[model samples]
Target chain A: MNGCMERIYNGLIKENPTFVLMLGMCPTLAVTTSATNGVGMGLSTTVVLVLSNMLISMLRKVIPDSVRMPAFIVVVASFVTIVQFLLQGFVPSLYASLGIYIPLIVVNCIILGRAESYASKNPVLLSIFDGIGMGLGFTVGLTAIGLVREIIGSGKVFGFQLLPLADVAAGKSGYVPVTIFILAPGAFLVLAGLTALQNKVKNNAAKKGKKVREASGCGEGCASCGGCSGKVFPTGNEEE
Target chain B: MVLSENKFMMSSSPHIRSKTTSANIMQIVTAALLPAAAFGVYNFGLPALIMLISTTASAVLTELIYQKLMHKKVTINDFSAVVTGLLLGLNMPSSAPWWMGALGSVFGILVVKQLFGGLGQNIMNPALGARCFLLISFTGQMTTFIYDGVSGPTPLAVLKSGGTVDTMSMLIGKIPGTIGETSVFAIMLGAVILILTGVIDLRIPGTYLATFAVFVGIFGHFQNPDIGFFDPQYITAHLCGGGIMLGAWFMATDYVTSPITKRGQIVYGMLLGILTGLFRLFGGSAEGVSYAIIISNLLVPLIERVTLPKPFGKGGEK
Candidate 1:
């Protein structure tokens, strides 16, 4: 129970797939134009991550070490297809909105990264918790970015017009949408901004005598993000 | 080039260094820009004046506060922020709301300039970058120019159509346009000051204007029917209107963002002129000077790499 809980904590905060690990950047940047779309994409990715983790862990010993990569993908893709059909049958609107990204989740680095790094070595139970944790973290990140972009870009969130778009349309001098926040550049700017914010929080914690890792280089790309959020634990925790 | 034997041993190079600080350079640029700024104020009245003050204040204060909060050296004394603000101000329409000025200034100085690394490290001209940002973000405010309840089409807009313009009015800066770009004479006066002080490399402005002239002349017949190829009025109007004069002299010559070597400067200038011609002739907007300068600014690194001064003995030895 303790090890499983730690895996969940590790994925959500210590090694967040979106903000900290920066794993599935394609769908994280795309398909996050609105809150609803972000939630839909996130939940769909979550289903794939969890099922793929369990299958890979179950077949970890059975799969030959030589063809482990292909074996993991086969398992992940099967689960992704199941989620896709489920989404297509039920939430057709979400399926339509997140059109290409749903299939592309088969190649999402987060699923593969966890399979190679965590799930293949860990027990099925711990791997399942890790998937849940990383999925929730990714969901939080995507939804937050979508919330900001939608609120500023369209004055709406989850199809709710909190700022009343009719005022802008009628020229009644109300809140006008920034419009750029929903554009492509907005994704990059918001991503950088959110990443910077996370770094600031971690740095502040480090300053307060917390046992956090010091950020070394300029935190721009994936090379700098690997060891973020104080990856103090040693890898190869087969002892558990 | 000989160094005296008075505690000044002949260093390998850079014997005589000018004592002009970045602050000094910025102050010179600010002084040189005074005539054009005054012309903007004269042409557009209180609104233009308010814009200048507000923009400049915002840029300076933003830089000051940003540096202070970031625990870096406060560099607002270096009038680069002021120059950035003033350039953004000049680029704005006279009828632009007050907040636009502050927003643009802050965006230019803070985001474009300081964020990339203050002063010398910015890759793009901060003012031009901010101007483009404002143009894209707030299109209506950036394009709407009105004075005294009379809003007239800008000379560039008129020229974009097949209409003719008052050449003399454009030359003397008595036309309808952005706050400062309307007055060729005033801009020329400032350009002269910049040139005379040796603050500007005339190679850039000269090649830029010449290339612009040649390109516009070649493309004149296609863009306008009233003016034939190499037509005098067409050439004058193209050169005089649409921030070309302001951009060629001031923005393109920015020491930090522009190419450094003589050959590189000429290439940068010619490219800028060609881009301006292309945009004016075929682009969505009438004025292409801002976009052209920025595009050229981006190419400066590549230009410098290709056009570095040859080692002294390499060519001779070969």
Candidate 2:
């Protein structure tokens, strides 16, 4: 149970597919012009990833090593095709928006990587949880990027008016889109900024962990008098 | 500590030094570009020549000014400014306003190259980056290509407008385009000279042209049923048309932005070719050499990692 929990938590935060691991960048940059498209693509990819992982885990032992990669590709491709057709039929707008990226998801590497690394070795239940966690992490990342791009690129969110563009048109202030945000270059700038932010947060947490260790005096439970090595000095005098 | 000091001094890395400095290389590149410049002048006449000279001079002047302002050594004698200016001039349409061409050159040298730590430190080809900036900023003016006595559409523009250029006119330097890009034969001559002089490796240009030919052949047939499978002549026409030759031979093979290893060069060239073909086919532009080169430049670091050469005498380890 603890192992399963660890796997789930690790995928969600410690090893996020988008922010931390930086996987599936092609689709991340390509289809993230609008929030609606981002969510649509993210959910579709998540569905495919989860289903593929669950099926691969169940059939892991039956698969041979020599033919494993081809077999995994075939399974993933089948799921991708089904999703592609379904989206085309039901959500035609999203289908048009995503365009070639739907076909490209077959080679996304993130889905295939998890299927090979985790699913093939883990139990079906654990694989399923891992898929959910990773998929959600990818979703959060894509949505965050999409929100920033959309709000700035078009001054709209999910195709609805958040900030009043009409007010700007009527000589009012505070509604100007940095049109570059809708273009490809903006995707790189946003991704780099997000990655830098994640690094800063992680570094801060690591520093706090180090300070806590120093204050705890190596956890030795020793009682030495004056000039003892285990003494925890007051905060002001710690630097001395 | 004594042994470490001795070993450091005796280290075998960077074993060779040469009289061939970056300044010398830039000068040679500018010299090699002369054939294309002459051809451009012949095809486009006096205005094109004037624009080219002004662009180059302004680029050099801008670099000097920036260096002076930043309190850095004014290294305009290196001739990189001239190379960038000529490349920028070659990228603009023959009849472009002198001011626009000069502005493009300034952007190339000052903003794209110098602002990013100058010369080798720039991530993308500065000339192409500035060209893309001009294209986006002034689409109407930038795309206005002109031919001899006929101020009209370019071959790519004609194609986009549902027409085809006379193949013979395109082959000769009579078709509409930038000064240097007007003649495929002249560009090839310059490329051959550069290769013979060892200014550039044959790998990048060779792979880039081959890959572009393959894609054009495949896609051209798919689009037009009349054009048979494996249309070699269409591939040639695609190569000769627009900036394909200029980019494949000169711009895409830029040493600073391109990968160093042979394998990485091949991958980078092929990727540039595929992306160029795709953008030409699907995107708004009929010619995508600038965007394609920039995209490939961004991937060079990754390609280097994947194709890194193994150290001698090192066995595989876990």
Candidate 3:
């Protein structure tokens, strides 16, 4: 039970897929124009991730070592197709807004990465917990970025107007939107800012003598390397 | 034990030293910019003056605070921030709110300049980069120029829409444009000071203007079919109007962003010319000087690599 909770905590904070691992940048940058789109895309990807992880973990013993990649893709694609039809039938607006990105979730590195590194070796229950944690982490990241972009870019949050817009024609002066925050460059800016903020928090925690994992190069869960972050425990001497 | 200072400090070549410092060069450039800034204030009213002051103050304070917090050496005394703020101020519409100028200056100093490594290490002209940032972010505010207490389209905008402009008025600076760019004579006055002080040479600006003129003359007629090919009036209007004059003389010649190699400077200038021409004539905007110079600034590393002069008597590739 403790180990299961640790896996959840690990994915949500220590090795967050969006902020730390930097996986699935395509969907992370795109389809995050608004908070609603972000939440919808995130939850859809979560469903696919959780289901794929469970199936892959169950069939790990039977799958051939040489053809595991193809087998993983087939399983993931099947789950993705189910999620796609459900979304299309119920949430048509979100489906249209997250166009092309829903299908592209098959290639999202976070889902496949978790399947390859965690699920392929872990027990089915542990793998499901890992999927939930990682999925929630990605959802939180996307939601944060989307909230910021929507607020600054259009002065709204989740389709509700938070800032009073200055309508010059109506002579009611208020906040003016910096539209660049919603544009393509805004994604890079916001991502950099959030990443820097996360690093600052980690550094500050490390300074207070807390146990913080440091990434050497790998995404903190490399099955091939036997966990790279465990080897080089940073002494807090090297500052970026 | 008292450590005695060594008489000889070992360093790389270009051993010949000069008294000139980065601060000295920056101060000179700041002085040169005064004429155009003065002209801008005269052309507009108290708002233009306020804009300049606010921007300069914002840029300097941002730099000071950033350096202080980071425990780095404070370089505000060098006057580069002053120059950057002034340049950004000059590029802004006088009608723009003062906070916009302040925001631009903050962005220029903190994000574009300091974040990349202060002074010499920045990837783009900080002023131009911030100006482009503001331009894209607030298109309506940036482009709304006021002349003679009335808001109207600039000479470039008029010419872009196939209307003739008074070249004499544009040359003499009685036109609606950005704070400093309206006055060709003022920019030339500043350019002369730059040349006299040896702060800049004609290589980059000269090539840039000549190529731009040639490009406009050749291709501009196609855009405005009413104007015949190689029309001098059309070409002159382009050269005189908008930010081209200020950009060619000042921003494109930035030491940090422009190419260092002699031959590379020429290529950079030609690239600037073609890009400005393309953006102005073919793109969605009426002016492209700021965008052109910045894009060229990004390519400076490549230009320097290709145009690197062979070291003395190094044999050809074996």
Q: Report fnat, model 2.
A: 0.00
Candidate 1, residues A1-240, lDDT tens digits: the string is 244455666777778888888889999899878999989988888888998998898898899999999999899989999999999999999999999999999999989988998888876766786788888888888998888888977899897988965353366766657666787777876787888899899889989988555333442432432432223333355322
Among residues 3 or more apart in sequence or in different chains, the pairs in candidate 3 whose N, CA or C atoms overlap within 3 Å are none
Order of the predicted models by lDDT, top scorer first: 3, 1, 2
Best by DockQ: 3
Best model per TM-score: 3
TM-score on alpha carbons, each prediction: 0.86, 0.57, 0.92
Candidate with more favorable, higher lDDT: 2 or 3: 3
Cα interface RMSD of each candidate: 1.7, 4.3, 0.6
**Model 1 C-alpha lDDT per residue in residues B14-64, reported as the tens digit of each score:** 777989888888888898889999999999999999998988889999999
Per-residue lDDT tens digits for candidate 2, residues A7-27, read 556666777788888999999
In model 3, which regions exceed 4 Å deviation? Answer: A212-240, B1-14, B315-318
Per-candidate DockQ values are 0.39, 0.05, 0.65
- Candidate 2's displacement at residue A211, Å, is 31
Where is model 2 more than 4 Å wrong at Cα? A1-240, B1-15, B159-162, B315-318
Candidate 3: tens digits of C-alpha lDDT, residues A143-219: 98898899988999999999999987798989999888888878887888888899899999989998665323434
